[model samples]
Target: MKYQVGQRITGVINKITDLGIFVTLPKNKFGLIHHKDFGANWLHERQNYHSGQAIRVVVIHNYRGKISLSKMRVNDSQLIDQTNDFLETKKENFLSVLAETVSNSQTEIKKLEQELVIYAT
Candidate 1:
């Protein structure tokens, strides 16, 4: 029922229009995949997205009480690989940044402690 951005979801195509494709998600929830999210190949082909065609999509946006989905990001091979690499890189980079911040904080704390000792004496 409750959907979050970047969450992968499965649904059936309920309607297709020039603007976008409407998907029927679980619990009768509806979402839309805009023309921009259909990807180049699918758009180039101009294939009719028939009703009941099951699709997997990622929740790209949720705003003003509307849910927007992206089929391109979920299904694009390059994007998928890039997404994985990006996440891994972020995870790997987090530790280094955190360590640097912690080290700096410790150094500052030690300096303040030394100043406190001098002031006390």
Candidate 2:
């Protein structure tokens, strides 16, 4: 079975090199999972991968006989999760600031009311 770009495929690690890991795709096509594309949290390319390990990868490039894969899609999911967490924290901060402003306004109003009574007496 031939794989195309944007297609997800399951393959086995056939070899590991400084550049990338070579996966044996169906029908003998070789796919490369590049070291740079392994995401920010990934450490030790060889330790992250091993011979005969099975992985699901998304194909990013297919040029002539050369095929490239990305575990980055999986990594991107983590980034998205982190982004969502940050957004939530920002939202909470905004709400807290708004509450503090309102509280300050209420305190000012009470102070003004006390001053008016003293002036009228």
Candidate 3:
């Protein structure tokens, strides 16, 4: 299967070298997760990602059918910033909708109270 950049995939660690870790994806396709891809938290025990270990990675590049994967996103900071922006916008929208609903309910309640007063008189 053709792998595209930014694709998230699950694979087994097939080999480990000083430069990087190699993973075997479905269809026996292989890709390299370079040493630079390891997050700061994992740098200490980099050798621990042994063969047969299952890992989830995102494809960072595909050139001439050779695929490169990243254990951490190549653009993790940008991705996190964008995600935070989207969540903030979503929260604002939810609050606005909730406020509108509450306003409408209050208006309806006032109308009901007026009708009840008219009926009582």
Q: TM-scores of all models?
A: 0.56, 0.55, 0.57
Residue 7's lDDT within candidate 2 is 71
Candidate 1: stretches off by over 4 Å: 39-48, 75-121
Candidate 3 lDDT over 1-121, as tens digits, reads 7787666778999988877899999887999988877656446757578899999877778898798988878445533322222345565598787788799999999999999999999
Model 3 scores worst on lDDT over the 10 consecutive residues at 78-87
Candidates by TM-score, descending order: 3, 1, 2
Which candidate wins on TM-score? 3
- lDDT by residue (25-74, candidate 1, tens digit) is 88888899988765666566337568899989887777875899888788
Candidate 2 lDDT by residue in tens digits, 1-121? 5565667678899998878789998887889988888655446556877899998887777888889888767444432332222345565498787788799999999999999999999
Q: Count clashes in each candidate, considering only residues at least 3 apart in sequence or on different chains.
A: 0, 0, 0
Error of 2 at 113 (Å): 86
Higher-TM-score candidate among 1 and 3? 3
Model 2 residue-pair collision total: 0
In candidate 3, clashing pairs total 0
| lDDT score of residue 17 within candidate 2 | 83
